[model samples]
Target: MENISFNMVFTLSGLKESKVNRYIYFVFVLIVYLLIILFNVTVIVTIILERALHEPMYIFLCNLCFNGLYGTAGFYPKFLSDLVYGIHLISYNGCLLQIFVIYSYGVCEYSTLMIMAYDRFVAICKPLEYHMKMASKTIGRLILFSWSFAFLTVFGGIVLTSRLRLCGSHIDKSYCDNWSVVKLSCLPTTVNNVYGFFVILSAVVQGLFVVYSYMRLINACRKSKENKKKFMQTCVPHLLSLINFTLAILFDTMFSRYESRDFPQSLRNFLQLEFLIIPPLLNPIMYGLKLAKIRKVVFRHHRQIEDSLHTKKR
Candidate 1:
């Protein structure tokens, strides 16, 4: 067998067909990335600066936005540079780092959402005990668990991938993914596959936990109009964000594992990038619009700014 290349750089083939429109694509993506940053940051700052919005639910929302920003930073900068320079190559270490940031972002997202679900479950199902159950210490621990669990889980996969002797350096997708890297290995990847499936199973279990929490919430809300109102006010935004993320992840997973070359290049690219593009953009928007307190705070801040500017102009 030929010696595996440790220093090989991977070529991202997703941009091959878009060379003609790379400039246009770059501008569009840049605008989207900027908007994502702006939207998420707006809410995050609002939560921090406004003490009223510093409850467990809002804290989790802030963390969610932070995770969105963290995840996108891993992809957008490198992607924009690739578009401008017409280079799609990433070094081996860079590839693994990207895989770690992006996938850990994803896992952290699910973990955060799961916590949000539990928060809602407590707030609605056990309103009297909600304070004790989701206190500052509890919320802090949950946040820590979310980040640590995601980092460790994805870290294990990255470590396994780093140990592999790679046979090829070309990645058909726009970004570095754990599965894609494992597929490039020259030898059997049984361990990686087994661990990968375990990760998937863990994520599925998280999803189910969120689902079960919501189910209990629905049952609890059925008895009281006030509970139903709270559910509509707070839980609806979480549900929308959850649905959006689920679909994006589902598309990327299906495409990465079972994609066909016969699909249109643009569609394929969209599938590959939907999670990065949609969730980060949509999560903040949904929270800002649907959550009453956030919406009111954001608009009030905008009005205050406008009034201050008008006074200066006058």
Candidate 2:
């Protein structure tokens, strides 16, 4: 009989094995995560409750909320534990799951933003047919396909990634991640690395196409200064989303090596913000502020909910 040894990869290195800083960072992330989750949840709930918000944009907003949920699902629990208890130990299985969740949600988010971009593009670029083009059935199918594509793309990476054998368990981030886990593999990581790179490139390219399409549509519709301002307003969420995703890619790529002892944990923490902090907070605020219709409907919905609850209590 032959014996096989399984080694722990992606273990913490240079980490003080102390609970102090890890717990502090964890608390910070926990507060941020809760805030983000609460905000996104409120947006989703408001949109669902208000018939006035039952439109293509709000539908896409719901999808974005779920994307945030899924993203936080991957990182929050571990992050919280690391914050309060300083427990960074994760089973190899757990690490893989984290990788899958983080990337899958990220891909889904990018796709959802693209769908929203198209919605805006149609609204501005082809206003006459916007309703017909963004019909409920059509929007439903688009959301379905966006999630499916995200699943398929991240699934490829997951399959490739599963092939690596962990030689040690020293991962070099405040959270579990794909590149950090993969960096610990003793086996040949060539295939997984290439697959990951492909995923990153795809996200970047698709995200830009979304941004460009929306901008072009906006420019085409800008016959009057007022119309131009409105068009730009409509594009704000998409622009912020695109920028966040782009910076994420750049930071992830730059720090992919994980061998750079020079890389500050603060920088790593900031990179984490792109995924955890920005989209959830910014999406709802941008939509509510810039899209007058959404703001009005959301406010109306909130009041209605309050009234209904008050009546029930009475």
Candidate 3:
């Protein structure tokens, strides 16, 4: 692994070492990645094709699925290719690009959820102004803001990481991340630390706002049966997804940043992969199962396909 900024390379030291185990890991991950792509793309296409599903909530759900695909793309392809190699290495630019895509996907998840929370809050608590406030134009602008914030913040961190003169190349993880790369640097990382804290603080603030919005949503639901049904149908899935994504990433981050050698490597590897595996596959499943509109469209299409097959047999 070279260290001259332009030619620098990183060694990913976390892959399965045995030849047989590596093949097993590769097939398993390939299955998971295909399912992730299938489920997310299904939801995205469902939303796009069904005009009735073109509401703000569904649009936000589409964006979430898009982010899932975006985030997973960062690690899965390269990791799968590396599985066949005895030594897993990534170029410095490749590392930075992976960091930017993966982290930005996380930030975008938080941003999309926050926007959905606000949409629910307005719909339930401020019913009269829901349409006016969450107009088509507003939703577009909000999504634009969500993605822009993600790109800019992660880019800043990437820039900070790029300036560091790395003294090491080995990263004891399955993929590249800003923190892991930063740890390779010999010099102090004060600026990177402050910026990292800022990013976390911003995410924390977003989480708090989401909590407050849900609280208000709960209160509003108490007075109306309709609101309660909506809450159960839509808001519950949103909360679960938020919890699912947040906890997976948080657990990964917790162990990644401050984990111990006392833990088993197998367990560490599985936990490290939770965020990438669970949310992408589950978010689309959750929304497809929980959201009535999407479910109806899915079921109806299934029946139609079955009927078409039946006719062909006849």
Candidate 4:
């Protein structure tokens, strides 16, 4: 008999096999995160070790590196552990902490990206006052605000989830998602669910709007000839991040709905690709590969530093 309860996970219409697919996902995700970790670390280290990359762009890139690091911290370890150990044994406190960290880090990453978009807008569009607008002081404050806001948003979710009395535990996902965890509460979860919906709307929806507006502004000022390349370079990473967030939220919401369980295991497994892995995997590539300036800085600085070291040896 299906283990059922009032606090049961109300999935959309699909019931993924969870075992075989989970391991397959683990291998793929592990590789992806490893690459991302390597890339982000390289970028961070290159920026720090090289004087040539001490500009505004690289500074923000460093922030992004840290943000991506925390985002990975939020999700990956738990996910890999679940694959090696088992998902059926996540402690209640562990689940809550996962939700807290994942949401916090995710929010901070997105918010940091918004700050970066603004930084780019100022640099590319308003080169005249770029320094005045994005001075070191200003950048520091912006980061502080971003981190504080991220904590508040994520902590609010934690407080809300903490109030609920959990009576069932059958999460199909690799990690504990806020909505998934709340769906298992024995007590009335109406408040937590409503709060969660608002959190998604506020963070995801608002973040998307900000990104969209910035891109529009970027295109408005860009010349027709250069627009295509600039647009692609600027938008690709944001678009990938947006798509990942959208899919994760969508499938997660679907996973919370009652009809989801009957949908079929294979179909649900396909959706897991976007939710569990794609966001982290695409982040470093999208951010690193798309920006010509960053690549230039990285390569130039690497060569210069090597030459300086050689000269010192002599």
Candidate 5:
């Protein structure tokens, strides 16, 4: 028995959604949000300031952090307000915007990683042409393409969604998603389904491209110790980031498609919140700590700041 929603406001019922001791949730979310901002901005600023880190790999890593920031921006603010007020209601337009920003961020993650892998592949397998292949102009084009591709792809879905007349306004997740919204539509979503399949096809294609690139990289790495070291230093982080994001999105995909009330609310909450929480918080940290040049520059800055604080204390 589906509840018929008369108007545009959608109710989100994911997570504990507790009014009791909600200040605890507020504080927790606030701390995590602040940490995300702090760590991501640290990596981004480090890349900007360090001349030694001006390579295409670092540039794409910076873009990954930017995507993380973009994605979290859609979630943390609204979520904090919800925690504070204990309200889970969102306007139809706000929900759409959330879906766009958050899903675009997800898509951007895949695209950013794809480009990053390409950068690594060229650098490792064709060192002589790396400069020619990944020049500043080329880099700019790729970044633009990554972001533009994501925005346009997600926007296409949003456009299709806006025309639908919803039969139910209740979403069983903490945030709005395109599928959740589409499920509410009383009209047949045949076109939407086709477009959705297209989106999946596109993603699958990207995944295959990444896998092929990595296979080539692995073959090149086996040829020399230096290549292996470089791969371990740079490529490993990207792989981990990819695996992290893949799992998070996988959880979300499963949750969206197979939602059931019999499952515990906590599990459902995790499915909804995993992508929003872990990747945004960890991606920068992973890149920051694992990549040698970034780690060096970061630690140098930390030491310098610590010394300056000690001098002030004196």
Candidate 6:
């Protein structure tokens, strides 16, 4: 076989079985995609419009919602298009771009959660220093660091991937991923593997940081009833979101690195798509329902809209 061409296209084998159920699957994906956009956008807009929610915690929540939208944008539209057209092919450059967006999204989720953990720690564990520690300028720098670090980490993986000479053009999953792409290379991927391990280790450390933050929070809350209530109201939602995201990412990682072709197609697909589906949908719902300030503003705006509609009808 000749070296992989610049214009080469990869056939995504994950969708081959969905041909008969294409429209049904398409409609289902379309509905979920719409919900992702609706819920995430609602949170983002609410955070932006409500000045009371302009604190570091809510700002981070807004970034998380926006990241959900950014990440899903890389997958759903392409998957929807493939479902409608009965073609599951992606260009070489397109696949790399998708890998960058999706993986960066994953990393950004962790980084954002880590910053949020810090924010919560300051708020609950050291209330007196919260404002000084998480001031507006400090929050801006933290946000910048979170997103920039994620982009550069994944960009390094993509750069390593782009240099490989591919031996095949088939990816067995519904979407492009760094591991799946690296597996296609004809030559040994030592550099890619090393860099990939570094990235994974970085994410694991971020997750550990969040866990440690919460552990201290739990212990601190044990000492004071008011602190316990604050932990329940604010930190619990972050913990839930962290757990949800961690599980989804774990499933995807396990499946990608140790995937078995013998597994049922449906099960395999679910494992691959879980992170993309569950976290984006769950994060906003969890935050909207659990965070008192967001819930109050969401409902207030909702009631105002309903009242306006009722008056119009009258």
Report the C-alpha displacement of residue 212, candidate 3, in angstroms. 0.8
How many pairs collide in each candidate, listed in order?
0, 12, 0, 11, 0, 0
Candidate 4, superposed: residue stretches over 4 Å from native: 1-27, 208-212, 215-219, 222-236, 257-259, 262-270, 273-276, 300-314
lDDT at position 235, candidate 3:
94
What tens digits encode model 5's per-residue C-alpha lDDT throughout 34-62? Answer: 99999999999999999999989989988
TM-score per model over all chains: 0.97, 0.86, 0.96, 0.77, 0.95, 0.97
lDDT of each: 0.91, 0.73, 0.90, 0.68, 0.89, 0.90
Indicate the residue-level lDDT of 288 in model 4: 68
| lDDT tens digits by residue: candidate 3, 41-120 | 99999999999999999999999999999999998999899987766898988888999999999899989999999999
Q: Write the per-residue lDDT of candidate 2 for residues 1-314, one digit (tens) a residue.
A: 22121334345433353566666666666788888887778788877877787989888988888788888788777767655655567776677778778878878888888888888878777889989999989998999988898889877876766676666666666566677766666778888867877876877787787868866876786676765775667777667876776677567657656445575766665665466677776776776677777777777767988999999999
Which model is ahead, 1 or 6, in terms of lDDT? 1
C-alpha root-mean-square deviation, candidate 4: 5.6
TM-score of 3: 0.96
In model 3, the clashing pairs are none
User: How high is the lDDT of residue 262 in model 4?
Assistant: 72
Tens-digit lDDT track for model 4 on 37-111? 888888788778778767776777687777777777767776676565543456666767777777787677677
- Indicate the worst ten consecutive residues by lDDT in candidate 3: 1-10
Question: What is the alpha-carbon lDDT for the whole of candidate 2?
Answer: 0.73
After the best TM-score superposition of candidate 6, give how far the Cα of residue 153 lies from its true spot, in angstroms: 0.5
